[model samples]
Target: MKAEGLKIILSGPSGSGKGTIVRELIKKEHFILSVSATTRLPRQGEQDGVHYFFKTKEEFETMIKDDELLEYAQFCDNYYGTPKTFIEESVKNGKDVILEIEVQGALQVKAIYPEALFVFVMPPTLTELENRLVGRNTETPAVIAQRLARAKEEVAFYKEYDYVVINDSLEEAICDIETIVAAEKLRSSRFKQEIEKVWNA
Candidate 1:
């Protein structure tokens, strides 16, 4: 039997650079980024099943009822979720599935898939995070303040994760996460069959 891939759940505060890290990590070709399902309308240049699996409100509700989704949450009147089938298929095909989500959704996934690798990304400092937010110039001063407040609340939940990496340098953070992934794959439980092979040999 082929060895199944790891189910990785990654979460981080806004401006923590988790997305950037994931983009870079996938360049290695072994990790498969899980596309999320959403009830929101497709934006310009967004393709169905590529950017997201767009669904109607009723379809999303059905998925929730049938447990077809690993985890889901409604945000700003739109529902977003990870489709369980996609992840299962990808892992069975020996592709590590990475799910980048918010803390609440990540916690929900943990309750169900306790074996999954839960990783949390942290900013170098709160002050640095604020600076990054301001540098983006995407939000008003009031909005940036609110995001910083929310970030503090999210940081408190990091204790629940199995691994935490600080994003001081992009390259260093990616290396840290890559090391974590390698270590997890070498865990005793994951090597059970290999152990038996060695013993029999």
Candidate 2:
């Protein structure tokens, strides 16, 4: 079985239901959501250290230089990264840390934690993704176009991940993710040492 503190990655196109799935999973499951640090201006209702830890570009650069970030990248002139310290502490506290990072960041995590579960969430179709993006009512038309283009590029990297989950139905997608977590908890690698302990005891 997998350990109590596994790092799970959820990635997909911008309009895909990955965020919704992640939110529901957090509400129902035992996992810690890893908030990202960003140099970009937060949109409406986006809180610092919650949605993202808002920082200046210089601060972000310093963190990178200090190797305080596990993985980081600049997109659309904004820098976003995950800090390593909180993730380590979360695991030590027996909480599985779920990182909703970009595909590139997920690749970096693969190198460091190959056993980490990689989930590639896709929408029902590209058309559906477009519709969802429009429905958000947050981005301008120009921003929507840019995001759509970026999503197309991002979705192409889905093959690099271990699992592909289609977010056609919210309930179904959430169920699949829950199932994956449950199965991961039963992995031989996770339970082998503990199995011996149980028998020896």
Candidate 3:
């Protein structure tokens, strides 16, 4: 069989349930979750190259200049990006690639890889989004407010995605994602050759 893998990009507001949804997908699917690299310090219980590849500012800058990153950005005070090499390797090996990136980086990815599947997970409303952010104790109230403000801008780009999956209930969202995955697998171009082979045989 000629196998092909998709590059799925998930983007949404802070505490808009993107992380939880990604975790659920990883647990239930055969996709490879691509960890992003950052110059920021690792958080509690975060392992090197697992949660993120903690790099020095100089190293990150070098990558930026070398064009070694698929998409790079400065968030808060730290630099973050997806490495170019691993993504290519994962797709070549027929493993689906999942990237949780910001809207700007996701837009850059769309321009570069039009075949990639882009999904925007959205909150029902800004107030509900703020509540979700505040519910997480990891950030300060001020920081949450800042994120909520930026989220409005980010969510505005939801129409650019191939699919819009609302993360209202975690389990229901997972089901929706499963449906998308199953449908993609059956798309004519993805499995037409396999179908022909079966018929010819």
Candidate 4:
């Protein structure tokens, strides 16, 4: 059997650039992005199974009761979660799977899948994070302030992750994350079966 691939969780605050980093990281052939399920209606141009597995509230609730979700959370009255089965199957097929999630969902995933690699993406500083949110210009001053405050609280959980990468430079941050994935791939435990086969042969 081929060696199973790693399960990596990339998490951060609202304006920490998690999406940008993931977009760059998946440009490499070895990484597979895990699509999450949501109970919310799809927005303009969002496609089912491509953007998200749009589920009915009842269906999502059923999944939760059946333990089908790897991790999930309710935000602003909608449910969002990562489905467990496909990720596990992809890993078993020797494909590294990455889950981009928020802090609470990431922690929930960590509790269930302790072996998964946890990477926390950070802003250069809280000020930089605030600046990024303001730069978006999509929210009011009040909403921006709320996001910054939530970001401060989220940073408190960064130490819990196995690796922390500061998104000071996009190129540097992408390189750092790629390095982490490459290093994890070469970890001894990942090749135990092959090692044993070599010894026996």
TM-score on alpha carbons, each prediction: 0.87, 0.76, 0.76, 0.85
> What is the number of backbone collisions in each predicted candidate, taken in the order shown?
0, 4, 0, 0
lDDT of each: 0.92, 0.85, 0.84, 0.89
Candidate 4 Cα errors over 4 Å, as ranges: 38-48, 54-62, 73-79
| Model 1 whole-model lDDT (C-alpha atoms) | 0.92
TM-score order of candidates, best first?
Answer: 1, 4, 3, 2
Which segments of candidate 3 are over 4 A away from where they belong? 37-66, 73-80, 137-142, 191-201
Q: Residue pairs in steric clash, candidate 1?
A: none
lDDT of 2: 0.85
Over the stretch 9-116, how does candidate 2's per-residue lDDT look in tens digits?
A: 899988788888888878854677997889999999998877888999999999999999988889999998888887878876778789987888788888987888
Candidate 4 backbone collisions, by pair: none
Rank order (by lDDT, best first): 1, 4, 2, 3
Model 1: per-residue lDDT, tens digit, 1-201? 345788999999999999999999888878989989999999999999889999999999999999999877889999998899999898888888999988998888889899999999999899999999999999999999999999999999999999999999999999998899888877788878877998988
Error of 4 at 159 (Å): 1.6
Count backbone clashes in candidate 1.
0
